[model samples]
Target: MAQGKLERTGFWPGDARLVISISMQFEAGAQPERGASGPFPPLDPKYPDLPMQTWYDYGVKEGIPRMLDLWDRVGVKVTSHMVGQAVDRHPQLAREIVERGHEAAGHGQTWEPQFSMTPAQERAGYLASIASIERATGTRPIGFNAFWLRGTPNTLGILQELGFVYHIDDISRDEPFTVPVNGKPFMVVPYTLRNNDIVRYDSPALTVDAYLADLKAEFDLLYQEAGRRRRMMSISTHDRISGTPARVRALETFIRYAQSHPGVRFMRKDEIARFALTAPGVPRS
Candidate 1:
């Protein structure tokens, strides 16, 4: 199979050597009680997992605010992938995310999977999420990310119909690309798991220092490569994960390190999508 690549002639705006996109996931209180448990045995749906619930609660009560402060102090903007129900539960925090110069993109109505839903159910979920985010933030989210990065075959078509301009579920490329959905161009800003905080759980032996080292290594290579072709480095953080003090400190360090280099810019996913729409050679197979 042939692979599609963004044109090397010119890529990001201002001829930047590299663009770094930060994703702050806000889905703590919106998660299903049984999904993604932490250090707890399986419990019946009839019973609530109190500890797990409160663990997620920490993200709301502490994580989001700490992360917001970090972004404010560092003078960088990020995209917050917010769950609709989560935003509804804390509209004030959602508003603050937008007020602090961050983009609020849709994650879903809740933290449950949408892939199993029928097309009608999926469409309804998308509609509900769009309404919730718009109601809270006063700006309709034009980008969508599915729960657990899982989406059904009908996901793109439904998102396009609902007026979303882009999605980040795709991880096939480092740069944003366009895919034809419903016979029109829809953008895909590829996400990353390599630089994601979830890896800490995926590999319990990993330390925060190791994680920071990985981020720097990834950035170093991409920054070097971007001299010839456009490159974008995506760092994924969650309110329950990277929003903690130690992890967020590592994140702050990485951001400042990136800033030290010339011609590197931090961009929101929407900004990347809009640029991909106009850039040449951004079509994917």
Candidate 2:
């Protein structure tokens, strides 16, 4: 029903196209230990360092280049959800994303937890993070995706207050939809737990075949749905996993397959947001 409602939106006027968005989480200013308490630590043993030097190196040096190659091949662009400090540290990389034509949005100062913060503190944290990103790249982020998928209850209003167009904080569905702000609609493009590589860290060895198989199934299912009505799908990859040689092959396969497909359009998060807002017969309610 939601997909049917969204399908009325014009896509290439006739044929279906896929718009792919690549969101990279750049968490350089890490405070994994911030939540520690009097007798214990915040970053429990279970949540060991998610972004270590090895992971960072894979993202910046090796994986980004491969991702760029895939983008070039597909004629798709990314909307990098960079951590504030990552932008500061990776000015050249940030410039390159903008230099080529992708949007550079905020991820956060560090991949620190945010769910427990007070509303005021959360707003302050957000502003400070955005300021850091802007200071480094000279461009303010128009979108927001909080680090570690964490946020405050007052997240949406605060984002509006800060002039953000949309946020990827909600992972309720696969399709791009909108949320209400004072009865004014805003985008809530979907994200996922099953569609991410983070699962690899949780259990089992992640292989290229497994990743591509997951992607292939999702794409096929969504593509099939396009025959009846319009649909959108999303997948996220990390440099640490995707950039790794073991997983990179699967990524390459998935990208190439999507590129070769005739009906899909690769686009960024903002593009989908704009489409949802203006598409005919669609409910921006």
State the lDDT of candidate 2 residue by residue for 103-152, as single tens digits. 77777666666788787877887788788777766788878887667787
Across residues 1-285, which tens digit of lDDT does each residue of candidate 1 receive? 234534353668888889999999998768786645665667876887788888788888999899999998888899999999999999999999999999999999976688898999899888899899989999999998997789999999999988899999989988888889988889999898888876554577888899999899999999878876778999899888787899889988999999999899999999999898888777665
Cα lDDT computed for each candidate against the true fold? 0.87, 0.68
Best-fitting candidate, measured by TM-score? 1
Model 1, position 72, has a per-residue lDDT of 89
Query: Which regions of candidate 1 deviate over 4 angstroms?
Result: 1-9, 34-36, 44-46
lDDT of 1 at 1: 23
Predict model 1's lDDT versus the native.
Answer: 0.87
Report the Cα lDDT for residue 199, model 1.
55
